[model samples]
Target: MPSITVRNVPDEVHRALKVLAAQHGRSAEAEIRDILENAVKPKGRKKLGSLLAEIGRRAKLTDEDLKTIEQVRDKTPAKPMTFE
Candidate 1:
């Protein structure tokens, strides 16, 4: 097993980590280990384009249906954003 030493961590960040660790009923070191593990691990999330493609595939939409959808979408104007 390999060990790592992290230095120069900000006091505010360290304090926050300690507080979070205490809330989770674990030591700060264990909390940090868990955080690192989660950060490095790959999360499963399907991309929007991929999901849409899959749905389109299952629906078996015709080329004319897709063309009509694009034509309708292009005709709709986008709403302007208002900032206070």
Candidate 2:
């Protein structure tokens, strides 16, 4: 697990966070973690895979079509980039 240190938070903001955490029945640290998680990765956010799947559904793609695409896809490993 990765850890981060939030430096120099204002006193009022810290107090507010503690109050909010108490209301939510969690510790201040847990509340801060939840706040950060939601801020970065909110509910109802559509990921790329989900979006692509939705598009495929909307286009009415079938299993056979997927198999055909899989069979025809390039299998070669990509060349690594070189900088001069």
Which segments of candidate 1 are over 4 A away from where they belong? 45-84
Alpha-carbon shift of residue 52 in model 1 (angstroms):
25
| Model 1, TM vs. native | 0.51
Per-model C-alpha lDDT, please? 0.94, 0.96
- Candidate 2: tens digits of C-alpha lDDT, residues 1-84: 999999999999999999999999999999999999989896798899999999999999999999999999999999999998
Best by TM-score: 2
The whole-model C-alpha lDDT of candidate 2 against the native structure comes to 0.96
Model 1: per-residue Cα lDDT over 1-84, one tens digit each: 889999999999999999999999999999999999999877987789999999998999989989989887866578989997
Estimate TM-scores for all models: 0.51, 0.66
The runs of at least 3 residues in candidate 2 whose Cα sits more than 4 Å from the true structure, single-residue gaps closed, are 1-16, 19-25, 40-43
lDDT of 1 at 67: 92
The number of clashing residue pairs in each candidate reads 0, 0
